[model samples]
Target chain A: MLEWTRGQAVGEIDTPALILDIAAAERNIRAMADRLIHGSVRLRPHVKTHKCPLLAHKQMAAGAIGVTAAKLGEAEVMIRAGIPEVLVSTPIVGRTKIDRLLALSRHAIVLTVVDDVGAARAISDAATRVGQKIPVLVDVDVGQRRTGVLPGEPALALARQVATMPGLVLVGLQGYEGHLQHVQSRDEREAHWRASMEKLTDTADLIRGAGFPLDIVSTGGTGTSTFALEAPGITEIQPGSYVVMDDHYGTVQGVGFEQALFVLTTVVSRTRTTDVIVDAGMKALSSDSGPPRVRGIEGAQYVFAGDEHGRIEFADQGSNLRVGDRVLLVPSHCDTTINLHDHYHVIEDDRLVEVWPISARGRIR
Target chain B: MLEWTRGQAVGEIDTPALILDIAAAERNIRAMADRLIHGSVRLRPHVKTHKCPLLAHKQMAAGAIGVTAAKLGEAEVMIRAGIPEVLVSTPIVGRTKIDRLLALSRHAIVLTVVDDVGAARAISDAATRVGQKIPVLVDVDVGQRRTGVLPGEPALALARQVATMPGLVLVGLQGYEGHLQHVQSRDEREAHWRASMEKLTDTADLIRGAGFPLDIVSTGGTGTSTFALEAPGITEIQPGSYVVMDDHYGTVQGVGFEQALFVLTTVVSRTRTTDVIVDAGMKALSSDSGPPRVRGIEGAQYVFAGDEHGRIEFADQGSNLRVGDRVLLVPSHCDTTINLHDHYHVIEDDRLVEVWPISARGRIR
Candidate 1:
């Protein structure tokens, strides 16, 4: 998997390469930091989007309190990268993950979210066996009924159990408004975002009112971060995709972040006059959200050609696409797209600056 | 990244693991070999599906003539693993990929398909510079307008040019009917399959009549292997996914291969009485073609919960799913799903077996 080295031109780099614009990404990170500087909420950017320790370090340097990880393997990578604070946002079950989480706690300040008593007890037992006190947050289901308990009583009950559990400290609550992230309208998104935050704060208050220490109230993502900062009790925000905005997030109104990530591909084959094929397909740019949007190619559409190739269809018959021509595509989803590659070709202007290994990539365990 | 070691129970393996049923996959390899043994077309199974050299060796031991790769990186991995013959089915453009392809030709009997003159000239120039005569195939567009020239005079012209070009040998023609691979009805699929072959053979005859020696007429996939074996001029079939069946290809009517690949996951969180959340989501099981199908769990449907979780909705409220229960899911698309993992946990009768590294998993250049 040897790709282009530093000082090579962008066009000279290999096809289907994950290219990150350093300037645009720095601007995105700086803008998010500026937005939350005066607010009560702190930034704890999720590492699952870039999965790069270098980028996570940039986020931490830009005023993030910590980083959020979706898996224990990712947290291990971040902790090995010398990140001091990391919160595993997803619940861990089974002895395998719990053991690994306990091992990770030896090196870093690790916190995990849990929605069930069985998982919480498992973590508590593992932490006790390792002679460590692990922090835990009660994951509350705000709108996305994926992995969380109910907001009010169910969350408070779990928090109470976690607070009393040996070798475990009850931190706060995590109520992610995942469904409200892509609501498509500012008014609708704000209305649902406010309601979701109110539910989270109410649960936080219920847990605090039950004479338990609730130090951290974490929530929000790239879509709901602005509204979540204005909410009453959200102590930190976890916006992952804002650093490398995708085509799906680019459509969200009021997000001033520029698209910073692209899959640089070459026109490999031209079948018809208007239909040119590129070297990137489902393996390069994920089609989970939708097909990636072609950057700066007017009246051109990117379609899935195969698992290893993509078709760029032009509306005009007089298209000038030829073999060896390079094109840029904004991925539909940044998280999954980043998971498919091994390294990122960090570019400044037209030159490759660095090739950072996606340290947490394929760390699904 | 320390997953379950060999000799562990299936339930004890880590969550979100790629599980390969050894017995079922062997049977699938044998079935495809049996179909091609007595026919005019020989089996040249594509390695892009499993991306494992061990599996490619199994296919070769089961009477496959060679292997087909979708990229030069995959061919390099296979050749390094001692697979003697490999045909890169996709066109290789740009200097970086062509240089790699030429380097691979020195180690094995390497071949690649070309649809345009520019790609052919580049391959020819690189092969000449490396002092190697690389085998080339004229990729004819049967129905997939993704990467191929037309199957008439255009293919003959490209074949002639490749034959006369320095350090390049025009060995055959490849016409893959990729669009006809997934037609629902058998009659409709066979109808289009026969037409695609007719076009392929017609192009082969045209190329031969134009004084070019056409040695191989290769085509077909897992969906159209049976029809392609019976096609008049198709001397070899390139079926990749039959060895490790997926949900999308399993729905194809007559492909009798058993589902061999599964994402082994554990129940991490359960929100509702019928809604059980597993540790596999978009990053575990690819949702590109569609959501994965749960194996053996009656009346249960898997839906995308988040990046790290999947919601299993049971039609009946009497669900027995709980935390730490393992479930196996057949991926919608095996190629992209395999790209997300680093190793395959091979299993035999619920006992742990060999853990094969997916050597070419991320070899997408």
Candidate 2:
């Protein structure tokens, strides 16, 4: 789709390009797939990070059971790309969204999560009209407290309600501990992750005790997936960011992922003696956590000058950054940064060899 | 493009929708036009905020001399939509971008800004090869120091070099005071703006005193357009965010722009007694400046939970937000937030009647 930078050399590539180190990314994919392929659990990598079905297919080929999509639109993209099974990780609530959910059910085994009885009833009514039995999962509040029902009784009650509905099958429980994904210390992360996993498996037992076919207990992110693998009843782990690590995740202890993604920018303005301005800013690279770090440029600070310019202030006064020089910035947050671009310039051995479209990039609906 | 939410009701519109308040936007368009119609300094409203050709056409119809696009890709979008003139505000660097610049000069009057002589020569060589005379402005650094040459001799030297080039016309000088855009006090903002204008006008006079035809002096933004209009040598002002004001600009003192954009979200998870979760998060609404403000909820505070969720906590304990309730969030910055959506759900009389595709939404290359 993006035809401008297709056959250009690595030095001649345009600024503000989302460049992916394909070799490092494939190593990351193999590392996570290796961790989960031999365990009792499996990997259901989330599609929200890469938004590319080619990367998802590689994970599926390695040994992922299915792909986890955060929204119904993402699930549609994955299902249409011939991804057989997709778990809509978040709860789908609106009338138009639930209608879309039933439409997805007609094509593939689209499993979705629900935190409220009303949301479950809405999905059930829409699916019943279309003559389909959609698989459902009750989301339990496992200390993240952003979504999901309370662990023991309330989650069981919602599952009981879903069991009574006609066009739904009670499949599993999803309890995500997103709050523990960024803990700095490994001991502290494991301690907190065990507590969240205890509540998830406990709630799963309670639902199964109530005569429900609760098989899948899907949870965990890139930070907690390794620790969550040691837990009892988690059938799968959904770690999206491990395939393309950023500064936010690379700093955490015991996470073995390397930096695989970068925003390639060109130095457009270097008139200042103390700083040089690049063509990447809030519109090019996101600053949700903090400003992106300049790769291989030690002691260089990046501050967003405006929406389309980034100023890099080097610690040394004799920095030789000139106009048209290329610079790479490591994103602080990968998910939001990747959503800003339309494609990825796949790089290998410092050469831009291919361009891949981020197909479901802004599929927020 | 987006076909799912085309015929939906305003009440039942999908979550995480970019809704535009057309009435307030029209008033914003008229207010700036009325202030500049009888004055010498014209308006060239920046298109990076709305990124819509329809809105750009409205501004041109009112009184704007032309539109200011931040990138050449955006200029291609506007020129294809029949806009006669577009000033690419940022510098067009590198081989690929300059190639795009020459291609645009064949269609419309595409003006660009440059601060580096190496960059200007690159643009000139390409334009000379194509046999097209491109208009250019020397960017002068008033105070922001992000881009542009220093305001006195450095700018004059660059303009002298540009005048000697084969296929380039040295039009004017541009000095933008981006750092002073958010000064809280009106008197303080005016004082700093005047000091910056002195450098800009002094540089303009110095360049014009030479045998150069320095006709168009371009500068100013949404925050400093009023003060820049009062300066003598300022020929045209470029203010972008006045069309759809956000919470960041709404808190400033004398800016009379109202809120005209909102990210419509739905309460998908309301489990905790302290907080409820919506479907807008870092991916839906940007958090570069800060979190998006809750539009009408008086005491509610919003924090991004994950990629596709937002958690809102009310000051009062008895807030009656349940599941499936709609909420509106005013983006902290309009330009970056608008880049995340593909279309705008235009709102009129509380109805979602029209869906206009943001043809230039992600034109950052």
Candidate 3:
């Protein structure tokens, strides 16, 4: 089925290329924006998902209050691209990162999180050195055991410390219910978020009781957007995956996001008895989470990832596939997959439309 | 630790920067060449690991016979830099990649592998269209179910087809014992290589017995370098990881490669209750293989990973780290870790020497 233009076929493009859908991206963007508008929570999109300034601008244009970055380099690129409001969601450690964060504050409304008193001291010292007071959010570790201080008095103490610090302004509390973001069952996810939000809200109360005004209380992902918005004292939600849903997030029940992003690969080789091999594999689609599902192919199982080849097995009639045939693969995880490519080929109606660079694709620093 | 002086001190340098030891690199390059010279196999280091033309040139200067590439784009970059010989080790399929491979035949001693007859025919046709007779090697599948055809008649038949096709030169067999490359035990790896190389040698024998000239019998890796050199038929060894040994490869017994690469991250904060958090995590160092070993720090464990922070725990000291401390992390896997960065900050001890661009860092295409 040659539905696309001849030259627009995947066989015509080079291997390991990232293919994006502008229409689908626009749809996903609008969907997230519409949800926030109908809900009570303000949206501060996490730009760490798609580290492109262009994508950040698109999110800002679609009614997002600010963009959140996982790295300072990412925030720098966003600020350079004229994005005035950005949040460095990840903790800023090291003098180099703190310096960058300090510099970023001069350019935009940059916000960072602190979980420990020492980290708060570091941020305060950096701000004092730069002669600029930076807004600090107490990161409460609700369920995601990765970072953030434990909820309750511990988080409240950090928030109080920030308020007293000379050059640091204790603005709010930021907690991410990351563990609930990928839970398949919506009820289970919501139940988990409700419990987590209770702790964050309790922490917020303690911080407020400590004579500090908490302006922003951000928590939740695309999976628990509605629950977080309905929760008491929560003012914002930072959801990243809703804009470009992967196989993992797309399967979340009751989530409006569709599996819009896919890696377009061509069937390069085939064996008579075994299966067909596509040009996309571990490098094209990350396997850190799990194996990708071949989109729309009946009873076909994808397995055996080489550096560049993906072996696909059909339940019946393996002979039906041949060289030059295009296949769409649903990536296991969207964030890591997007980081693998230099640019995204924006396709619309099976035709070449535009190309957007993953401008901050490899901005590790 | 302040040795080299390219610019700033290691403490002053930014977090999550790739640090390469230039002196160690030169020694590693010569070490691979020396090992190959003392053995029977010719060294054709895979440039896919480093993706730097300067490093490729250094490999050849250190007596590597040729360079191997994982993609045509890398081969093109290397060829443009005047590296005369190259082998696109992966199968060249899809019209665009085939066309690029065909075009590569004009300027360099281009060689590629073919596991399927259909791919061989396509490559031959593309080469014939460009009026160039490109050399082809039968990629024999030896243990790693990733790519290549099975040894014996399946491979011999493909070799026969390649010989029959116009504009194609059927070279010998190419089989990589990739599974052996990471076998923790040297004895176990050698045994596996001995078994796999026997099958590949027999396959090479079948082709040569059929009156075909088998010149290049390429195989092996840094883990199985010595084993492959001693193989009866493996004329060349492709060892890419030896140039910059990773923590994973460094643990291999009798493999003299040093831990020359590290992710220079700085601690931004410290706590009396917990280990310091550094500004480098999965985004800086890949966790695909496992957590990176903290070089020279005994009883130290790399705990919880965020997108941009690696929490380090030293069991005995119970928080010996302080703010602004520089931590050098030995990556678990070098190949994937290098792919995470844009440039390599070549350092001798603690000072920056030169920043080498990972030119083909994301050259999956």
**Predictions' DockQ, in order:** 0.82, 0.85, 0.45
Best by lDDT: 1
For model 2, which pairs clash?
none
In candidate 2 chain A, what residue range of length 10 has the lowest lDDT sum? A1-10
TM-scores of the first chain across all predictions? 0.98, 0.97, 0.95
**Model 2 chain B: worst 10 consecutive residues (lDDT sum):** B1-10
Candidate 3 regions exceeding 4 Å error are A1-7, A317-319, B1-7, B268-276
Better of 1 and 3 by TM-score: 1
Error of 1 at A156 (Å): 1.5
lDDT of candidate 3 over B133-185, digit per residue (tens): 98888888887765678888888888888889997898767898887787878
Best by TM-score: 1
Q: Can you tell me which runs of candidate 2 are displaced by over 4 Å?
A: A4-8, B1-9
Tell me how far candidate 2 lies from the true structure as C-alpha RMSD in angstroms: 1.5
> Could you give candidate 1's per-residue lDDT for residues A70-181 as a string of tens digits?
9888999999999999999999888878888888888899998989998899889888887898898899999888889998899988888888899789888898888888
Ten residues in sequence with the least summed lDDT for candidate 3 chain B = B1-10
Identify the runs in model 1 with alpha carbons over 4 angstroms from their true place: none
- The TM-score measured for candidate 2 stands at 0.98
Which is better, 1 or 2, measured by DockQ?
2
Worst 10 residues of 1 chain B by lDDT: B225-234
